[model samples]
Target: MAKLLFQRVADEARPPAILGRPGCGPPDYFTEVLLDDLVKSGAWLDLELKRPFLALWVNDEDFDFPDWNDPLIAIDQANVRKFAAMDPVVDLESLRGMRVYHDEPYFR
Candidate 1:
């Protein structure tokens, strides 16, 4: 079940799809600033992911900020095999299992 779900997210988050490109290619920029906005705007739902679990250090007062280190950004095998394959520059394997903390912070 998890494999199928991961594959679905991998398919949806391809750079072209996320960047609204008409053809295959990486985007000119993959910036953390943009990523932060995407997180706060809940744009990742375009990939069908729920709002991510927040980190303990994330200030509740920092409503405008979303931690890039959040598990929502964690790389999995499905992403490595699908989305990450498009970029040769990234060492996707080394990024696996990088969650610094585990456990959901807030209840929806």
Candidate 2:
């Protein structure tokens, strides 16, 4: 199963009413519950400590922002830096050839 996610700082910019709150809704019932469990078990935080940064690139146009790649890319970089800061195990300098993607335009 997969889900589209954005880090807190990126999602909360100017208060994202679109992303809404996380929970078990009709469209993402399974992923929602799994995420809740992960939160309770501190799995995501642990992953930040042990794994490379997880990034899912989403088109800004689909999210109601026009030509927002620059800002989105900036957010991606910030997420990596912030995560590295929070977890000593994250080696940003050692991560090479890593990239943020430009997902094909998402359609409703």
Model 1 regions lying over 4 Å from their true place:
1-79, 100-107
Candidate RMSDs in Å, in order, are 15.7, 10.8
Candidate 1's residue-wise lDDT over 1-108, tens digit each? Answer: 233322233245433123222342233222222343333333333412211112111223332354547654342222322332332223333443434333222111
Tens digits of per-residue lDDT, candidate 2, 17-88, equal 223244435443332233333333333354431232333212222322334467644544454445445533
The whole-model C-alpha lDDT of candidate 2 against the native structure comes to 0.36
TM-score of 2: 0.32
The candidate that wins on TM-score is 2
Clashing pairs in 2: none
TM-score of each: 0.21, 0.32
